[model samples]
Target: MTDRSPRASRAGLILVPLLLLAALTACGSENDPSPVAPTAASSSSDPADDTAATEPPADAEPAVTLVDPWVAAAPQGVTEAYGVLVNRSTQARTLVSVSSDVTDVVELHETVVVEGGQMLRPVDGLEVPPQDGLALLPGEDGITLVNVERPLEDGDEVALTLTFDDGSSLDVVAPVRG
Candidate 1:
């Protein structure tokens, strides 16, 4: 007689999935050399859902989005990107880093009043409140692109990639303007 218990059945089901996952992971394409980041289960007990911070909940909305993205017109030297970072997710999002197609060096900056005058200073991150937004205004808070590679003429577009604290990134094209 074969002994088949509920626990034994559950164990077999779990083992099958694990084996299948292992096999699929090992079968990578020849051209694809990048590794996919692992996402662990969220330990939160929210009533809505439990998804990783890097991902939106079951509601299916993106965590953050860019609005009115544009780069300042510059002949060379330094310039900045202007945009409004809108947060639609339940949790707040923090912008940790920013990069552009025109320049290799980018930084988060804010205007600070000093004894001499108001000066631009570096900031670590910019937080977008839940269901709110943070605007990048000139002479206020923005992403500074130092040592621009070429001239940023009006109507030209630059590709911008913004990374958040959750390790999720969003890409957008910003048109050069005044």
Candidate 2:
């Protein structure tokens, strides 16, 4: 019985060290910034990965940036697009025209109060001040898409081209939402 007790104590000593080593190895240090393994959807070989492609080039800085452009869902007749136009340049810029593939006519419009009712009035252009921005919002100020060829539903995507007064144009895809 005495010999058996010594053997059991030695076994326990060996097992304890092994368990401690395993626990230390499993816990990684916080300072290590190891890259995680990419999932199947975000793999490099997937052609749908547009994160790198959509980024603007480092050498070129655009004067104007359209933020969160979206189109409102409406019936077959007409809808509107809204977004924020941010101007980074020192000179003012004007939105000259807007065209969309889903609509034959696109017009800039502003809401006005007439006879205690609100109405959308057509406007020639929308201006963005120097080093400032403009928000094309709903109900009051927005771009109206006239003669829509098809009915717009929520989650539909529409392609639009916005032309500026300086002959510069920007192509954007606006998502339709209610």
Candidate 3:
């Protein structure tokens, strides 16, 4: 009879590699875990839960919202715009500059008591606090729109662009009011 022991040993050596290869291939198959489904307690059908999901996170980007923006009616020469700058973000922002098609020059101004007289002075920028607001009124403390192209009449809409230090800008068509 032929010596079968050596042949069997050789066959076993080949089968060992095949078995290891099968084991490795099995492990390499896609076995990603399924996403967890929302439970009844966390479902958004509840109004409170829906609101929580829609709210921005604590570290979300700063959101600057302009509310009730209006330009004062000017018979001639210069005037100013008024509004509430609401900052909903966690970080403070700066109002860098302002522009408008109705005027050639727009600048940020603040009122200061100088020698017991309140005067308007140009400021580089205005800081808007986080979760707070800044009011731009028609006074020495408000922003000044200089050299208006024409007299802004009541009920007219003027396009105003506000620039922030973060390179973001807001364009608003503010209504002209007294």
lDDT of each: 0.75, 0.74, 0.72
Which of candidates 2 and 3 reaches a greater lDDT?
2
Model 2 C-alpha lDDT per residue in residues 21-126, reported as the tens digit of each score: 3454355322221235656665677567766445544444356667679999987888889887767556899998999989889999878888988899898888
Candidate 3 ranges beyond 4 A from true positions: 1-62
In every candidate, how many clashes are there? 0, 0, 0
Alpha-carbon shift of residue 118 in model 1 (angstroms) = 1.4
Q: For this target, which candidate reaches the highest lDDT against the unseen true structure? A: 1
The Cα error of candidate 3 at residue 7, in Å, is 99
What lDDT score is found at residue 156 in candidate 1?
94
RMSD of each: 21.1, 23.6, 29.6
Residue 70, candidate 1: alpha-carbon lDDT: 89
| lDDT tens digits, residue span 72-158, model 3 | 999878898887776655579899998988877998989777897678889999887775667665443466889886888999999
The model with the greatest TM-score is 1
Q: Report how far off residue 143 is in candidate 1 (Å).
A: 0.3
Query: By TM-score, is 2 or 3 better?
Result: 2
Better lDDT candidate (1, 2): 1
- Model 1: lDDT to the true structure: 0.75
